[model samples]
Structures are given as C-alpha cells and as structure tokens.
Target: MMRWLSFLQLCLSLLLILPLPLEAFEPLTMGAIGLGAVGFGTYFKEYTYCKFTECCDDRSIPANIEALRSSLNRYLFGQHIVAQHIIPALSAHFQSRSTSRKPLVISFHGQPGTGKNFVADQIAKALYLKGSESSFVSKYLGQADFPQAGMVDAYKARISREVRNKLHECPRSLFIFDEVDKMPSGVFDTLTSLVDYNAFADGTDNTKAVFIFLSNTAGTHIADHLGNLMKGGKLREDTRLSDYESLLKRAAYNLDGGMKKTTMIESHVIDHYIPFLPLEKSHVLSCLQEEFWRWDRNPDSQKNKKLIDDIIDTSISYDRTHGLFAISGCKTLEKKVAVAVNYS
Candidate 1:
C-alpha cells in the first residue's frame, strides 16, 4: 500500500510539473491523476499554504458594512457624524460590483483621542479576519516613518515603492497613514497616482484598495465648528457632514502639514473627509463607565459616580467656554481608570 501511494504521489508531481494536456493521457490514467491531484492539492492549498500566506477570502474585502456599523456604534464613542457618513460611503463603495474608478481615499480629520485611529482599526477589523494585524494592512506614522525633514525626496520614493509593492501583493490592501500632519510636504505627492482613477498603469489595479489619512490638521476647525453649532443651540446629532467637510478640506489644504499643497487633495483624490468631533463631558463619562466595566470594577451607582467625578475633576480637562467638552477626549481615560481602580 505504501509503495502504491508513493508511486501515485510521484506520478502526481510529474503531472503537475509537466503540465501535459488531459487529452494526452488515457481515460483510466486521467481518472487516477485527477483523484490524486484533488487529494494532494486540497491538502497543500488548504492546510499548508494558507498558514503562510494568510490566504485571502471574503474577509479580505470589505463585505459586511452592517457589521462595521454595529462595531462603530457600539465601541466608538461620541462620533455620530463618523458613523453616519462613513457607513453609507463604505456601503456604497463595497456594494458596487463594477470596478471602481478610483481608490477609496478617506481623510479622517480631528483632534487626538477622538476615535480617528480607532475608527481606522474598526474598518480594518471589518474587512480582514486578522483586522489591523492583517498582512494586507499597512500602517505608517509620519514622524516615525519619515523623521528627517531633508529626506523628503527619499521618503517620497520609498513610500511610493512600498505602496505599489503592497498593492501588487494584495490589491485589496488597506493603507493607514497616521499623524499625517507630521509628514513632510510632497511626501504624499508620490502617492497621488496610486490613489487616482488610473488602473493597471504600472501593472497594478489600485482602485480596489483603500487609503486612510488620519490627521490633526483640522482638529481645531472641527471642534470650533461643533462649538459654534452648540452655541447656536444646535444638537451635535443634527449637524451634517456638509457642515464641516468644506472647513476641514480648506484647513487641510491651507495648513502647514503633509497634506498641504499635495495633489491628492487639490485634485480631489480623497473621496471623503470624515470629521471626528471633540468629545463632550458626557462622552468622557461614558468612556469612564465603559473602562470601569472593562476592569470588572462595577461599583455601586453612588461609588461609581463619585469615582467618575473624581477622575474627571483630577485628570480630565474641559474647554473654557461652558466646560461641556473634554479637551483630550477619552485618550487618557484607560490609564486614569487603571489608577483609580488600583487606588480605590
């Protein structure tokens, strides 16, 4: 039996390597070859190569917008505009069976700790089974990746090559550029072509990929816009993307950052400018409650309220106007919670 199996395996290897037409083989030989190929090919492709390649599947693409929506709604705190605009845009983008004219480029503009990076991670998680850790996902930090101001030309070439290579490897790749405000000017000029409508120009169809730029460039504009709306007695939920989209674009374009004077923005390669509003005091409290629950420190209502208040007064800083909004959002809440839990 072992001898027969080895003979069959050898025959299969030869058949695969030679690529002989099926018509060249006799009917019985073809049948045996087909059986052997199916058995061994299935084993190698499914169990062996999958472990190394992180084989692509339905999860490799953005298929379930509703799942993403649910995740953003549940875990992402106090960014209604983000969910409202982003979900619909993503839904439309993924729903279209036709090839895209351009890559999906979204610029997340907001203050730090206002869920910019968090939302990017959520999008990655929804698209790939491994989420942000997926091989297809590439995250770049501006200051970290391109620190030297004199290395603009070098950075541009390197970033373009990296992006092209990644897209070549996985066309459905997700590229997140964090702290984009810190990157050197013209660094992204190399990427304008990759994110543009052109397809297969350099043997890579980039239209299926997604590029996300997270910046604090227009954070002040976003917060001020929201503040103005609030001052006029307008609810944050009532404000639309239109209210802040133009403001953010203008700020990003005018601001002295990586995005300034870039063709990607001027030519409108960026499809959406999603604004993350500053977190209000109520949002901070929600974050605190969530953190406490995460730590399994479910104190009584009074004790929990006291702890939250103490944390807010001691650690959290509020805006000067009405003391309604948190300056740092929930970025520091987890650490503060840990300390509070340890002490109390």
Candidate 2:
C-alpha cells in the first residue's frame, strides 16, 4: 500500500507540474489530483469554489492596493486617525501574513454621525473586492439581533454558528457588530474565544478573520476627553491613540454595554481602540462638500455657500464658544442640505 501510494504521488506531482491550462482539469480529475496530493479532495473543492463561485470573497489579497487606498482616503472624511493608525496597522497585518495571522480585532468608539459605521463599510468594500454586499462580510446590528434580555443565549449561539459557518466557507471573513453598546455583555465574552488563534475540529480557522465592534457608549466620554485636551492647548489633530485608548477601553468595559466586565479587554485581545472624535464645524463643512460633490452640485457656487452656512447654523450646538460642537454631527446635514437646495 505504501509503495502504491508513493507511485501515485509521483505520477500526480508530474501531472501537476505540466504546463496545462487550469480549465483543462475536469471536476473529477481535480478531485483525483487533490486526493493524490493531500490525502483528500475537499481542499481542491474549496479552491474551485473560491476561483469560480466566490470571486469577490475576501479570502484573497486585493488586486489593486493603490486603488483601495485612494478610495478609502476619499470616502472616509474627517478620519485622519484612520489613515494614520488603522491603515498602517492593516498594512503590517497584510505584510506579515504568515508570522502572526491572528484575528484583527478592532473596536470603534464614538458618537452618532461620526463615521464609525461608514468607515467600517468602506473597509469591507475595499477588502472584499465586492463592495458591502459580499457574502464573506457579515454584519450584525446589536439592536436588531440581540435586543431583549432573555435572548442573550440564543444570540450567542446564532452568532457563533454563523461565524463558524462563514469561516468554514472562507477563512478571511469579516464580522462587524454595529451599535454594540446595546448588545448584552455576555456576547463579548463569547466572541472572545472565537477570535483567538484556535483551529476548530470542523476546519474553521479563526486567525484569518476580522472582528469590528462599533459602540456609542464611549462617545460622550471621548468627546469630553478631546474637549479637555483642546482646552489644555492640545490640538485635536495632535491627539494620538495613546491619549484615549485606555479611556475608551475603560468606558466599554465598565459601562453598561457589550463589553462590560468582559475579559476581551482584560486579556488584551482587541488590537485597537479607535476613537472617532466628534465632528467639528470644519469637519461638518467637509462633509457638506462631499455631499455636494456626490450629488454633482457645484460646491463653490454662491447659493451652495449660503446653503452650507444655513445647514451649519441649523445644527444644534453645545459649545457656544466655538459653535463647532454639532450635536447631530453630519447626521442631519443631508436633510438640511435638501431643504436648502430645494428652497434656494
């Protein structure tokens, strides 16, 4: 049996070494080749599935890194922190793929209308190569999925199953949990285990997955912290991750939310605690300009300038000194812009 297996391997190796088109191998032939090489044919099936059925899956490296970088830079407005920290972190992660290969766990903490969800969507689009609708990218809303008290266990089971299923299908899956501040605290602990570098019995490898948690619980705290920095003569742009990373983690772990008392933070598993600072007037102005360009409206027109001013005027503010503390951020800017554009 050993001699027969050795002969089969030699023949298969020679066959695979031949300069032949991939399409020339039929399904049965591919299965045979895989069996001879790997002792089973399932690996070949996964390759074919990725090659033909799931062309947009995140399992492969993006074809155009420069294009992705440009799009991310363009779309995620007012997020220079992302370009600074998140982009470099991702670059390192991708570059040293074989050495670490751990799950990229990121937590986005910020106020509403700050671009946490927007940036998350953009990242998924860039990595999956299929926009936001890719099968490998799974998103769960805390309010929608785990709203009630008694549903915590059920939610845990379902998310675990879904995550495992997706990872089994494609190891490079992306999971985003939006509004996680509303989720039950126990859920975080459940996910903590899965995010670790462990291979399941059913062939689900968690190391290649990415987990993102978005929360509003730490928003006010983050805003206050940044505001204090400004008051102390520290420029907002000069605020680094070290300034607010521990604060965000404290808020998430101590506050009444998904991560409260969870070991995920204590164990130091979360790769980054990204703070999405509250958008100021200039940032809001940038957002308005983006909206104008998105709708093909000329931003420099006199009418548009008045419209932008009106939008900024109407957005309620907390800080009377700078009038930059937009309570709603850019959330209401669209409707404000619409009213301005239509009425003008």
Candidate 3:
C-alpha cells in the first residue's frame, strides 16, 4: 500500500510538470470580442473626424476678393503686385467651376525674407479660413519632405496620395510646397496629373483645389530686371508683369532641380509666376511698424519712437550704400524690434 501511494504521487508531479496546448486555456466568446472591437473602432473614428473637421466650424475665411486683399495686405507687407495679380485670378476661379477647368497653380519666386511664404499662407487662410493648420491645407517643405535623392520617388508617391486624401476630406483643399528650389526634379512632375483634371471613380472632382509653389529660383533675375528698368529711367511702379514674367520663366527653366524642366511648367499648368521684389527701407519700416503694433506698444510714446529709430538704425542691410533693403528682409525685423523694446 505504501509503494502504490508513492507511485501515485510521482505520476501526479509528472503530470503537473508537462506543458499544455494553448487552446487548453479559456478564451473570450467571438460575439463579445467583436462587440468590444466595434465599440472601440467607432469611438476612434468619431474622435478623428471631430479633430479634423473642427476648423470647418469657424467659417471665417474671406468670402470675396476685397476681403482677401485686406487680409493679405494687413498681414503681408509690400506685396502689392502679388495681391493685384492673384486676387483677380482667384476671384475668377472661385466664380467659375467646371469639369474642363484645371486647378489653380501659382508659383511665387523671390528672395528669402520676401513675403512668398507669408503671401501663400494669407491666401490659404482667407480661402480655407482655418489657416495652414487646417485639414483643407497641406504644406510641405522641400528639405523636410524629401531628405535624400533615393527618397524622391517615394516622396512623390506619398505627396500624390496625401493630396488625394486631403481632397477626399475637403474637395477644395490647398497644397503649398515651400522651397521648391530645393525639391527634387521629378517630385513636382508627379503633381501634373492632379493639377490638371482629376476625375475619380467615386464621381468626385479635384480640379478646384489650389497648388502654390514658393521658390527663390528667379530672385536674382527679377532684381536685375528691376535694376535695368531703373537704369533706363523708368519708375518701379511702371514695371509690369510683362516686363519680368518671361525673364523669370526663362530663369526658372534654366534651373537644375526646380519646376522649370518639369512637366508642370512644360505643359503650362502653372497659372502665375508672381515676383516678390526686394523690400526697400520704407517697406522694412512699415514691417517694423506692423510688428510694433502687433506687440501693442504705444506708437506715440517718445520711448517707443526712440526704440524703433535705434533698432532700424542698428539693423544690418544688404545694400548699405542705398540702405534700400535689409539683408533678411522683414525676417529679423520683428525680433530686432522686440529686443529693443524689451531692453529699453
């Protein structure tokens, strides 16, 4: 009897040490698991929808051409020509919508510190009303989006998909590609199809979307054209789009990586190549005034006046002889003013 009991105990210990199949464990019922998954998925979907569509509730986007112009002028200083050209084109495009019309594609070319990016932002802000952060607007930086030559193709594919996805979310989405001068050559070529007429299977059209490409490709040529006009005894205001548009286009086409050789330009999908002339001292001063007002500094105060004067006098300019423009345009003007105000 004792031997039999010892044998029974050893068998029990062996059984406990052996592994069991995974299926031996109890599991949740299919119905219960499915219901929990559905609940979580539904909640996630609604949460994402609310986050993206929140900007839509504002409805503060400029409704008319005059409103757009006012917003642009107030926010972006010394872009009078850009406003004059873009506003009319925008008004016409907004008024007319048809299957035959392609999406509006505008390229802004200028030096750094010029209001190229600012103007682009104001345009999208006035139209989308939610600013650049909206779901309706997709902004890309060339360096940030495409870091390597090997990644250009992948970047192109992703960009096309993002544009389509944004359009699906909001058909009239805005795409801003900043620093096109640094973008890969083939990247923008991919946008040609979308920029033209895009008819999807779901009966959705994306031709009304806007594409803005900002580059510094034609900056020097634009400045040269203006300098030539000045040398010929012509006033800067007298210079028109006709004078520099062709030159600017040619200069861009000559560039190696920008939109010049791309199909977007070859096929003429770009509607405008608006030039942003270098800012003069007066323009910089105007920018300074705008910055000061933005800070709520007392404009009439003698201390503030002296502060503004000292800041302007000390700030570096590219053309010291003429002092026509700051080296960084209004890019550093605001910071300079802030520092002066804080110290004084």
Candidate 4:
C-alpha cells in the first residue's frame, strides 16, 4: 500500500514538472514506475526547460515580422529605401523552412541621425518579447568595446568566443554592432567565418543568426549622391537602391575605418548595404511632430509650430547647395525639442 502511494506521488510530481499538458500523461504501471520517474525527471528538468522557452520557438516569426514592418513605417522617418528593402529580405530569411545559405548580414550606412540605430532597435523589439533587453540580443559599440587598436587580437578572440557561445545557446540570435567605423580594421576579420555561407563555429550552425552593422562611414557618399540626383532634376522619391548601394560598398571597402579592407566586404559576405539617406526638411518636420506627440503636446498647434519653426530655423542645418536635406538630420532634434518643452 505504501509503495502504491509513493508511485502515485511520483506520478503527480511528474505531471506538475513536465511541460506537456496534463492530459498527455497516463496511468503508469507500478512494476517499473520508480526507475522511469527518476530518469524522466532528470531529462525533462534539464532539456524541456530550455526547449519550451521563447528563444527556441519560431512560431512568432510571422506576427513579429508584421509588427516590425508596422513599427518601421510608422516611426522611422525618411530612408524609404531602408523600409522598402529590409522588410522583404527579413521575411525571406525568417519565414523560409529551408536553412539559409548564410545569416542575414545587413550593413546600414548613412549620416548621423538617419535612423540606423532606431531601425535596429525596432527590429529587436519586433522579434523578441523583451526587445533589445532579450538575452538572445547582443549589442556591441565599436569605440567603447575596442577602444585601443593595439588590443585588436584580444578583442577578436573575446568577441569570437562570445558569438560562438551565444549561437550555441540560441541559434536565432541578433547581433548589432554600432559605430563599426570606429572598430579596428582587423576585428571584423575575426567575424568572417561566422557571417559566411554555410558557416559553423563551435559545433553550432551560425546561418540562423542575424548581424546588423551600423556606421557613419558612407554618410557623405550617400548625401553627395542624393545631392547629385536632385541636381539632375530627379525627385528624392524616385531614387532607388541601385543609385546608392554600390557606392556604399565601395566607400565601406576603401574608406579608412573598421570596415576598410575587411575580408567581409572583399568576399561579399555582407548581403545588403542599406543606405540611410540624409533627411530632408519635411522628414525633420515629421520627426519634430513625433517628438511633440511623445510629450503629449499638440504637434499642429500654433504654439508648437512656432517652437518647431524656431528649431528648424536655428538648430538644424541644411545642404549648402540645394537647402533640400537636413545636414545634421534629426539627430539633434530630440534635445532641441526637450529644451523647448522645458522652457515653454
């Protein structure tokens, strides 16, 4: 009678511990119940815990992708090219069943305040429940992490190990490297194998990971190209990816910075070179309106317009030749808006 009670207690414990629904468990024969319970408990406790977590599931991909698209369109100003190109690429990579030949590698190049970092954050928020704070998301700032050029070798090994460990733990990881232009040239070489096609490291398949590289390296080229296009009587809306992608790649490869002469560029490991174009005056206005909304202020009110006009007139600088593009982009607008809100 005591043995039967012990078996029932063990069965109840298993029902509580296992991730499966209660209905999945059935009456176990008392003959070998004790031994089976012990083995099952050990395996489920260790394996099922991780497998059932949010990290291991791709069921949220479609909903997350839709959320990402909505966020980008609603929040990100200017850079229609970025919004148009990135969505399709991301959808293809995440939704497909067959393993990708390589991880999705996107290098965002543009001037300051053109929404590179903002877009990256939105992508993270859309994909993970905790967004940028998710354990699976890793962000590295080039200047802060690899400040000294002399420590390139040590930085390489550390970053390589970190990437391997993260991918080993969760294959669907996102790595955002900001200020890549400030990182030492050789540091990216260490990441070559991790980003390449059919690559595996530390016994983990790296093809499921996503890497986003953000830099101000090609901002000038992007701005200049846009200026030239406008000068030739082309509307900014009509500008296409072809107009700036090759220029960005060449600038990234030949320019002096983290990406200069990096193997990633030379071998074409970077799948997309998305250019964040210089913000026009209208885009800056939209940004100011959004900032106003954040503060619960009426963006279209005369008082707000007066403040926004002052900001546009005094704080933001436009292209010297055409006065069409915002020189500093929307980078400085947030502070200006905050100051205006405080004073008014």
Tens-place lDDT digits, model 1, residues 1-344: 67457657776787775677767889998888688769767656665467556765453454567789899878888888898888888777767636677778999999888999889998988888788989999999988998887999999999888999998887788899999899888889989988987856578868778889999998877887789888899998899999998998899888977998899888888999999999988788888898989988774578777999999888888777656678899998889889888887
Q: What would the per-residue lDDT of candidate 3 be over residues 1-344, giving only the tens digit for each residue?
A: 67447555655754763366645544664455456558655544454454555433224334356767887767777666787799988887777744446788888888788899888877776786567766778889988887676787888889888887877766677889988888777777787888875567865567777889899888766766676677689877777777878877887777855575788878888889899887777777778778888898875678877877776778756654344546578888777887877776
145-174: candidate 4 lDDT, tens digit per residue = 989999989988988899989988878889
Estimate TM-scores for all models: 0.86, 0.82, 0.79, 0.86
lDDT of each: 0.84, 0.77, 0.74, 0.85
Task: Name the top lDDT candidate.
Answer: 4
Clashes of each: 0, 0, 0, 0
Regions of model 2 farther than 4 Å from truth: 1-52, 55-65, 319-323
- TM-score, candidate 2, is 0.82
**Selected candidate, larger TM-score, 1 vs 3:** 1
Q: By TM-score, how accurate is candidate 4?
A: 0.86
Cα lDDT for residue 149, model 2?
A: 63
Regions of candidate 4 where Cα sits further than 4 Å from its true position = 1-10, 13-54, 58-63, 199-202
